[model samples]
Target chain A: MTVSVDEIGNLFARREGTQRDAAPVLIGSHLDTQPEGGRFDGVYGVLAALELVRALNDADIATGKPIEIVSWTNEEGARFTPAMLGSAVFTGVTSLEEALAKQDAQGITLADALAQSGYRGTRAVRFQAVDSYFEAHIEQGPVLEANGTTIGVVTGGQAIRWLDVTVTGVAAHAGTTPMPYRKDAYFAAAQMALELEKIAERRAPRALVTIGQASIANASRNTIAGKVAFTVDLRHHDDNEVDAMERDLRAAFASAAKTRGVEVSIETYWRSPATPFAPSCVALVAQAVDALGYSNERIVSGAGHDAIHLARYCPTAMVFIPCVDGLSHNEAEDALPEDVTRGANVLLNAVLARAGVAATLNAK
Target chain B: MTVSVDEIGNLFARREGTQRDAAPVLIGSHLDTQPEGGRFDGVYGVLAALELVRALNDADIATGKPIEIVSWTNEEGARFTPAMLGSAVFTGVTSLEEALAKQDAQGITLADALAQSGYRGTRAVRFQAVDSYFEAHIEQGPVLEANGTTIGVVTGGQAIRWLDVTVTGVAAHAGTTPMPYRKDAYFAAAQMALELEKIAERRAPRALVTIGQASIANASRNTIAGKVAFTVDLRHHDDNEVDAMERDLRAAFASAAKTRGVEVSIETYWRSPATPFAPSCVALVAQAVDALGYSNERIVSGAGHDAIHLARYCPTAMVFIPCVDGLSHNEAEDALPEDVTRGANVLLNAVLARAGVAATLNAK
Candidate 1:
């Protein structure tokens, strides 16, 4: 195994080919886990890619294009946030300096952690040198298993928008202040939450709206809430639909605040636009699954992955194997070995198609 | 000034009279201040009571019954919660043991704090020997000031009920979970809040409903909220009305949770029944206000005071003077000197009527 580390600590294992200058076909995922992470999440994808390289070696197959297995860093983002940092930086979506400067909860910078862990390297990773990318991962939701499918040919990732909402109202004695005199912040916030649910309902199966974090300042059991702040996460497959959803949420909040005699401010914090895989790459992955005679279906990724970042710079697709109950980022996550083997086979064949088997060409 | 401390830290200063067996008239309020308290909230009432005694002594006017002034402890409850601990114990609303056991955020108990401050005493303060009680305070609301009134003869205090609510839903990925599948806790909580406000509006002019504190566990910016806990405070002058308000709030919350397919639990944390002072005592206070030739009005106390506890056991009344903009419990709180003097005169006359002038009786 030939291994190299990039400046941001991405580990790349390359298997040499007949032509070194020919762009390599990249296959990999991240190598991080959530606080209560399962063993198979990021680790499964990395191991599967490594197994693909081993199987090709066992078959005595050399390709025109080199094979590289990558292990991205901080994709879970539980320790250091803004996930998929390694791939984002490699593709130039984020600067290497910024990713290195990112700090964890303990205030330890990424660069410091890499240096301390002895993974810091001078080698630079270039996305332009990657001919194509394929990743194999466990489905983090109940979609595949519930449908009794063994494989999921991921077509694209959903659009994501994060909004920060602040509701300002008059704080008064809960026992003394009459309803007419109150500009209760919680009341306005509650109305906004309810209205957001309604908006999501109107959009139906494609909409995913959630209120995750909420808090009020000077909170007490008896005083009226004066100010409340919460986070809203809206997701959809279409970028225009996601934008419309945000507009609806803002308008609803404005109306609710006005009716309650409160003030509200909604700020869009971060956004990830929908990333659709190249049709040819998606078809190739699906064809591999069909040729292997695996139960499979087309699906969209509910969660972000390194593939989403790589998709922006090159043709990319992902193969998903069913996880037990689709539970992920949790310690209780489990998967069957047979499914893992099937996923690896599909990944190997898909990579072989892109890299072009040199032995087969010589034989011909 | 013969000052003595009680076992629970109440400060009593007695002025002896010819008939020591006669029940003494009690006059005063608490001396504690809020964290961001004004100089004139409880302090004004206390100083006014002390000044009233000084004026009577300077004029050589003695009463038939003994006169005593008390300074209640922990009225603000900012440091140790469940305010009015001293008065509540004095009137038997809360047991002395419970009051002593109540701890602050720092885990310091009331008994420990009093002992550390050297305020704990061996003297046993008895409310049975008290003939009547009068408290002079600044109106902490805009009703009197907005109406251009100088003094308010407080008739009674409003009833207060504190309820705790918890909403439980399913936590899932914001980008993957469809609207139909999500049992969003924040949505249920928000709907309940909005409905509660509407319920209060239905009972408007008297209902005082508020949601003070709210929180979601394991909250993140992208995941759906799994659980939300909040406090609801409802108050009214009519005990039956407050009960109905509680019923309405519970029903609304139950319905909202059911609609959202979420679980909810409502707990009643605390309750203070409405206390109406004796008609005779209220009339005497109004008479004193009229005799002082001040622009006065009969008003109900929206906030809890030491008088409410005392009212349960004896004839108790309160004299309120207008504060600038009716702002209290804030460092920016202010009141005109004339208003203070006017309230003091009204309190003096009321106490004189109850205590009876010994010199005038001797002359007769």
Candidate 2:
């Protein structure tokens, strides 16, 4: 089945070129979002793709292959998880059963959600078959806003790490169990998080640490925590930095265990090393953005993307457009229509330049 | 029925005090624990009272009233909700019907548990009738450990603020949800904890923020957390610090809500400001500790105590000794028998100094 941006009126065109050697540069973005989220986040990227395609046609230029556009299903996972339901299927990191078998807060499964939405597609974007993947998105942070950069030519994406660390203690009444006599796991975890932040900040400009998930067992206002479990998400552009942070994290945790006289165990959920971008794609985009008179910056992406997933099997590159306050994924997420079009022009020009298409567009 | 250390002995005991404030200072502590808990935690404080009673008798001092030593039924609440189950019942915070109605992990209610153990006493110390209250316990942290001080002669008990903060975000697939598009509650809560720690630490020494209880709405290894809720225990020895910390905590949370594009609601469980000991109670303990050749350094108690609850009705004082490695409520919870004895001796000497006692050989 062919894809199309119904709302933006952008047509999803298939690459006429050979799948790999004469591969068509794939362009797409997530189309779903958080329920109360900003409309511009996912929508902007989709519209940008449409604008890029329209500009290519306007120039009356064609490549050896056709570029495919995508609207990844459940990109927001608003209804269920393992989001990017369509793209994950395309990448094959997860199976269809795992992706579609998810249940929402109300126990509605993703398969049912997809069926109800009337947008479930049958075809997939096989990665081994694609030449390169590209996507445009909001910076999601204040970096682009503070720096006034218009176009970001991503050098690479940061490594991602997920962990669940549990420290178990004895639960007792808070009032009756003398503090000196109580093993309080919650206190130790809190102190560790505070100290861990320092470890990240000291290595800042690159290092980032987040305790994204936390919980305590047998928790009550009047009771000492019996067990505390939390997930720590630590990331950086460098693998060594990520490793060092993890090591330091373990040390801090062990020390806390010793101090609190509690037992601790850490479970790793996912680990991906920092992935390098398609070098030639990055160079081409850098060249194109400079030619287009938009300040091009070789930025390291803080947020992970589908391009990273595609990088495993094929060449991958990412496009970043300035977002207002660098806001994203919220109802307040916004970027001027002008900046978006400017970004589309850069994306269009960059793709054309890379794919050897002599194209021009009135993006401005 | 009259209560004694031996009648409740093994079941629970107070190390007994030599003197009793006419309506004997209703000294209390829990007798049960989660199987792995430390021994000296709840046990030692009660022993301190028993020992105090013993010392007063040895000195042939008599106060005008009958002294009662109590080992409350199931103060640990390991199998139930509040560790101070007896005290809660005594203070009317929980009715005997309610206390008895509650069930343990094994589905045994307090009444059933007590009935099975055959230790429910017909007599309960009238909380309002006590002349004054004094409890000697081990200081749970390095405040005394790092200081080489033998006593945490508390001038005031730290104020406690409990809050349950919930972050609402879209639960999506971990692999597919673009970091910016997913409003992960776990990530949001973790960041919130880190920031809360920062705000507290910035306030320093006084703003003690500990996240003691936490939970995710639905837990999964791969799910982008749909919702997460955690308990924040913010404390300080100063009332203003409590207010300031609460404000900073809420403000930091607001920023997280805005940044993460999620809804955040904080439910306050309780807010108790720094409670000072009655000056007379503080002075008596300070003098007694110094006279007994223990360090007279008066410090604030980091953990809440029965004295805090008792402070509501009667003048109360807390005498603290050091726990080995500042550890408590764990199998690893080891305190020198000598320290336990010394704590009791201090309590003995202190109570004798306060209420005056008749002949006794009271240390249980």
Candidate 3:
């Protein structure tokens, strides 16, 4: 076994295979967690990978391909933005220099933190040849627990789009302005928010919309709102459907503004296309869940994960165990021990399925 | 004429009457303006009273009853809250001690400010007697200008009601939470705002409603809103109508909250009843407008004023001229010079009509 830390602080433990020249099967997840996050979110996945290696060593099992356990850096983006920085750099989605230069709220760069921790290694940041990748993580949602499922074979991540909407009107005294004479920006924004909900409702179970932030400029209890700004988060499993939702959102906002005699401007600040895991990898995860006799369902990841980046370069899939109440990024986030163990077992079997056992081991 | 300053900083310029024992006719307004206010607003009313006195002097006219021009203090409430403090105290609506104890944002008490400015005289703050009260000021609205009228004979002040609404729900990840599983507070608040508009619309041209301030708790662009707080301002000429509107607002908000699976609480924090000016005083202003051959219309004061308090104890009416774009309490607030002069002329005639000219001046 050999241990190494990549330039971007991704920790890796490698066990040589019977056929050493073959590409390694990678089992990876992030170790970093949100600032106020619970104990089991990111660390559970990293420790699960470590546990898989320990179990294989105890059985003296050998595979045709080498197996590598990786713990990626800065997956939460709590201290630094643009989460999954380690995976993003490893997949070449973001440059090594850019990831290193990312700064936290205190203005400390990722490079500075890595160097201070003595984990900034000389090894290359980018991934080389990989046979397949598998990850185990908490579901961070209510679906699995609500449906009484123990394991989730995650096939993909939902597409997400963020919009900034600004509504402009004329401020006037709340007492002096008659109903017909007002161009109330907050009222127009409220209408747009309701319209966003309707658009999401039309698409039913798969579509989601949120108006998480809203504010009136120069807010006063006795003055009509002159300007209002709010953020819209829209998500769906299909990119085309999310695009359709965005169109509906924009049109509805424009119509509401027109009705209120106000002006509206929408900016699509960030967008991430839907990510679909490889079919063979997904099938392997499902096969593992079935072989283990665990109650499971094929689910799409609603939140971003390191696996999404790996899926771009290699056949990849995920195993999800439900956290209690679907709470993450919070201090109270929790998952049942039995569910966690079941998820880890599924991940181990999925990786083994992708990297075949040695002929000698099969004969034994 | 002799000038005097009262303990609460109200300034009075008194002209001896032909019948000295008769109650004096009072023409008064505030001299203070909003922090960011333009040149006119409060100062226009104060100077118009002075102009009326000068015009009578120029015409060598004397009145049977004594006449007084007054300038009230802290009417803008920019520095101290509960506006129209001086008049409120003078008319016994608010105690002088309470008015003196009011503090500015800088923590300076009104009493301290008056003392520092040498305007806190030994005279009592309360008004003893007055034949009638009149004020000339900017309309602070678009109505008069839109109608191309020269004067607005303000008949009464509107009833006003302020409400604080809070919507509470459960916050969840925007991406992970499906629409059916979520309780979004902002969406609920938005629905309530639209309902407020609908209620106002039902009451038509006279009723006014505004959601002037709104905010989500712990706002994040990618998290479902858990709580929202907002202010509702409702106004109408009739107190009964305003009360009815409040009921409508509460019912609509509760319905919307129930529909969204959220909890809503509404607090009627403040209310001011409708005030009707003395019929004889309103008639006097109308007669003056007609005698002066000025284009005019009857108007309800949609905003608060010192005159509202004075009407409790005296026959009170107001004369208003159009301001530019209905702008007030802002640096850009403006009024045409001719409109200002015409408003002052109407005020002069109204005061004279109430406090009849002496037989000697009538003969002249």
RMSD in Å for model 3: 2.8
Candidate number achieving the greatest lDDT relative to the actual structure = 3
Q: For every candidate structure, what is the RMSD over all alpha carbons to the true structure, in angstroms? A: 2.6, 9.4, 2.8
On TM-score, the leading prediction is 1
Pairs in steric clash, model 1: none
Q: Given candidate 3, what's the lDDT at residue B244?
A: 96
Candidate 1 Cα errors over 4 Å, as ranges: A126-128, A336-338, A360-364, B126-128, B360-364
- Most DockQ-accurate candidate: 3
Candidate 3 lDDT by residue in tens digits, B261-362: 999999988999999999999998899889989999999998999999999988899999999999998999999989989998888888888888885455
DockQ of 3: 0.71
Residue B339 displacement in candidate 3 (angstroms): 1.2
Q: For each candidate, what TM-score against the reference?
A: 0.94, 0.60, 0.93
Q: What is the interface RMSD of each candidate, in Å?
A: 1.5, 6.9, 0.9
Cα shift from native, residue B99, model 2 (Å):
15
Q: Candidate 2, TM-score vs. the true structure?
A: 0.60
